[model samples]
Target: PQVVSARFECPSCGNIINVSQDDTSFKQPTKCGCGRKGKFRLIEKKLIDAQKLVIEEAHELLEGGAQPKKINVYLHTDLTSPLTEKRTNPGTKVLITGIIKELPIMTRSGSQSVLYDLSIVGNYIEPIEEDFTELSIEPQELKEILDLSKDPKLYEKLQLSIAPSIFGHERVKEALVLQIFGGVRKKRDDGVITRGDIHILLIGDPGSGKSQLIKRMSVVAPKARFVSGKGVTGAGITATVVRDEFTQGWALEAGALVLANRGYCMIDELDKMNKEDRDAMHEGLEQQSISISKANIQATLRCETTVLSAANPKFGRFDPYMPISDQIDLPVSLINRFDLIFAIKDLPDKERDKVMSRFILKLHQNVDSSKEVPIETGLIRKYVAYAKQKCFPVLTDEAISEIQNYYVKMRSTGVEEESKSVPISARQLEGILRLAEASARIRLAKTVTVEDARKAIDLMQYWLSELAMDKETGKIDIDKIASGITTSERQKIVGVREIIIELENKLGKVIPTDDIIKEAETRGISATKVEDSIEKLKRSGDIFEPKPGFISRL
Candidate 1:
């Protein structure tokens, strides 16, 4: 397969013959003109570039009880290098134009058998789907999209169109719409890059339509992949190195994130994922790339993919009074990476429930449901695609001033109160900028205005109020969401630690747990709160149990 050209010289007449091998296998010239049939003297030979690729059916494409099929493809010459090497990597969907050829099978005795294995000799290879810029839009459709962007209520209309069949998640739907348009990615002169994609997490009760919303988003997004957390592995979500039977060596296989590059990936049942598997997403979310080093293969795969994930609370239902970090099983580090988190509770409100019930019943009874959706699904997709491809808005002076004022005001609250809790961080500020840019993109605006900044701030405030507000302080404490500990809980832990130290100093080395709790009570901490804090400190190795009901500082 590698031989490009071969030279042959006849033994009888010294006539030289030059032949080029173009077929799958080596080809010999039919005639030498002198008619010498014996083995000729081999003089010169040249080899060309060649490679093998394996294509397998994606897991999502498989039906129940069905196994994915795999095929081997052979690539030679120009197709082996340059473009195909990047686009036709493992796990990426590709449309290959090739000629199917049969390879003779060999028996155990090394003799050619009657049976043959089929393989494709690829002539051309291209991705199955292109990016949004490559979308084919008619002139009339382009005009309609531009017109839709000009509508006064375009934002509200798009929000209603998202998951129209699902009722009572206007905020979540609005966030999803912003995520589809996204923002403009920027690379500074110093080489720092800021990602434009938004990540959202939905923690809700069962039967709250989280899955349905995710499915709807995948449909609206130009390129998207749906994956379940329980079914995905660290390697499956990131990248892996596996043995390639065709090449008899390790080959790098791209994962879901890489496959969905420059698109969206929806992960459902997020809480069900193992710790190690969830940790694999850390770099992908923050750095927009996945790095793999295993089996002598090391590489970083691009994964500029937006993530929309859904998870159920630890107890199968959300607890409104509890901090969001405490309700979900995900680590604070991973949770904080998401730009927005919404709790879709299934609380009972008679009037709202009545309205939702009527809406669903009317839809089931074949009433006119089209009135609920302002925009059709096809047009919505095209509009979003056009916006993302064409719009790249920059922040205006008014927008910058608005965002800066909000950040400074929020930071001042924590400082003025002398609260150990952080009201906001640079990460949240970046999220605000990204959201403002997305808002401008929705209007097809070249500059993010004060109005866009205000919209972004309103959404951020809504999320913070729902998920990050401290019940005791009545103030936003970002640490409650970024770290698992609230300010009150942290203070209680500090009090318990001090009580333990005081007792140990007064009553020799080991102190009774009951004495520490009794002392903490005098310091205004309840016995139950003292015990809870003591247990946490012990778990974190700040203190250790010498014996039953006895504690000592570590």
Candidate 2:
């Protein structure tokens, strides 16, 4: 409803009058100057399509489990167009100028009640990127942040500041700090772009401080969103497509990831999410964008947000000898998208258990005392926001040399090119570079130094040692995490298949399980491994069981 001038003619004395429709409701001149009391003849009129929407508060603003507040707004005329409607996307912020009015509410008896509802007749609206709140830092605060960064133990202090009550996992805390101050996004002359946001996953035992870290992070970061996998859908994490009856088209609605654009998002209990819901996040995590095409509505929303997710093991506990991928139900493709994956284990140690118990008791007795951190949570939040907004570190020659040396040396560890168990790939190299840049930004430095590169490499090596090690070969293998199948597993499968073929040639199309196990054991493979390999081949349709004790290759 754009403001249009409408003219009405009076039948009495043939008088002409003009009236403007500037208000939400149309109004005609009650009585023309000619003293006419009847309906006036309409000589001109203009109508436009419009729609109403209700916007709710963002997830970062809520404290714990509070319900979000909502407000109603109306879009007029051209504002209802597809392009314009995308600006004021739900889940993001918006600044609007409008006139508020109260409308009567209907009671059970179908009559207007005394109470009324409030709505705004919007005249203008624009998109706004929210950073938790309108956090404005003064000049004095900026100086304090700079001085804090210059401390010799700056890294340790920052790590201790996050989740102070947690006993261990200093490396995980350091990684989270780096995640807050991400790397610089690069755009080349050819229009190709590289994502700077980092994604990390933590899978561990049940009571191993995973959820506690996530909750503390929600308070430590100025613009952090917290979500759980339970009760979440594909549309809830990415974007939802709704059928609009008024426009007879589909409308796009932003979800958790989009709402946290340029910020941090923590997802707890990640393993509990449905397969479809988890698949929807593959594009958002890598490309930094969310695309939805449903009912003829196709669009892409920018989601340059960093993710830190946590999950528990499928069997309720973690085993040191088991492969990380085998213990979790996530797909290999999704696993490869994460820049860093940490495995947190809870083991039994008398001394460590005693100290942890004492810490927990003290926390339960007087929580305030256990909350002591090197820096206050609020100032740390402001410091993170300032570093992300003002600092962008570029790689220096020494830093590049450090990264290159590490990659060249690591890649050379494999045996041969053809079926080599690559220890690392370009994906890991990019992750290390991003981490190095972020480490420099933590100190507000203009260029990444050699020290930053080494620190990032050390952290990456730590994670790899725990999750990416091939237990059978006693060597690091990237395929373990990247493809969920290691060189050792592949070798076992091949050996079992070859043994079956040789047995068929001698035993006439029938292979006995006892003979296969004996041959495998002679080749240094255990009976259990041989049985597992045979089961794997059977499931893959490479072989089948002809009788209870025999298996034949198909």
Candidate 3:
């Protein structure tokens, strides 16, 4: 396949001639013009660069439940360079200028069949633009975008335009708006990179419009893939290696995250994913790459994808009394990766219920009663694209100080004498910075001011108060939402363990369950709390039930 030039010597006349092979196969000159029509002596052959590539349709381009199609492409000479090869890698959307030719198919009986397979002999290839940064805007549209950015209530207007049909969730809508207009990703001089993408998770009760919200987000994003957690696999979400039917060799296939690079991936029913499959997202979420090392095929594929996911609680409805980590089936490590986690509860409120009922009734009656979108969808999309393409905001001194002071103040809230629980960490600080950048981008500002910093802090404070703060201690304990265990619960478990130790010393090796519960109650731990702690300890192998109604520490 790489043969570029062939030289042959005529046996009769001893004439040396060179021929260039440009077609799919090597060709020999028919005559040497020496009057001798016999076989020529083989001289020399030169070979150049060549490679085989597999091209497939992108997952995002598929519609109406259609599957992606694939074909083999032949690359030669200039097309086989490193830069061109990288641009044509799997999962990347590319435009190829090539010749479509047919290759003879081999039948099962080992004969060449008349039927042929189509393949592309690529002469030129280029990757398609996958991010809004490459969006093209007209001069008139640019003027309109700049004018819209100057509006005093631009943020509020964008939030209102997100999903007009969904009632309430103003805060969630605001977060989604910021997510759509992402922050500026930066790389430090030391080569460390920080992501600007905001990952949002909606954990709500059944019939709370979570799926509808996800669908709306997918529709609004410039490039997005809508998938359900139940239907997705580890290979489906990341990268996998498959046997190529045409090549009869292993070929790497890009998954959802890789296919949606520089875009958004909306995953509904997030909690329905299996543990092993969910674990595969760890690298893609944090590192923005998926490393596949299966079937002797090892490669890391880029996946700079922002995830917007929705999930239902384990018990079919959210439990307001329990920590969010306890109510969901997802691992605490995985839950912590989300920048913002919102709980959408369906509570019983007389006036709110009446309004919701009326809204649904109006929809059923074919009457338009919903509030009009503050900004049209097309205009907003262009506005967002314009901002993302042209605006890259940097933090001002005042903004940096604001974020720093808030982080210091929140972390210092723990009691000085006790084992201080971390109220907020550097991760949240990074989140705050990203949100502030997004806020500034919304206004098309190149500098993040104190006002933008304040907005970010307010949103962060609201999320912390609702999801991270412990009501009993009146302090924020990240462990409550991050580890599925609160400081108060940890203290109760420690108290129960202490009671068991005391009883074991006072009584024999076996301590009665009633005595342990009575001692824990005296120490201000409720009987039910003590019993729950005991069961947890037993399951963790810290203690064991020696006999009925009796326990012994390991």
The lDDT leader among the candidates is: 1
Q: Sorted by TM-score, highest first, which candidate order results?
A: 1, 3, 2
Look at candidate 1 and give me any clashing residue pairs. Answer: none
Please give, for residues 187-216, the per-residue lDDT of candidate 2 as tens digits. Answer: 899988798888999988999999899888
TM-score for each predicted model, relative to the true structure: 0.91, 0.85, 0.87
Question: Model 2 Cα displacement at 536 (Å)?
Answer: 1.5
Off by over 4 Å in 2: 1-53, 57-69, 75-89, 93-99, 103-117, 122-129, 132-135, 245-248, 320-325, 416-419, 502-510, 518-524
User: Regarding lDDT, does 1 or 3 come out ahead?
Assistant: 1
Task: Please give the range of 10 consecutive residues that has the lowest summed lDDT in model 2.
Answer: 126-135
Clashing pairs in 3: none
Comparing 2 and 3 by TM-score, which wins?
3
Error of model 3, residue 494, in angstroms? 1.9
Task: For each candidate in the order shown, give its overall lDDT on alpha carbons.
Answer: 0.86, 0.84, 0.85
lDDT of 1 by residue, 1-554 (tens): 38888998887888889998765456666667887676778888898888888787867789999989977888889897776686665445788899999888878897889999888999988786655765678999999998998899999888888888888898898889899988788889998889999999999999999999999899888878899999999889888898886567898877888888888999999999999999999999999999888988888889999999999999999777766557887899999999999998999899999999997887788756745578888888788788888899988888999999999999888778745678888999999999999999999999999999998999898998878888778888888888877777798898788777778779988899889877887888998898899889989999888899998888
Clashes of each: 0, 0, 0
Q: Rank the candidates by lDDT, best first.
A: 1, 3, 2
Worst 10 residues of 3 by lDDT: 363-372
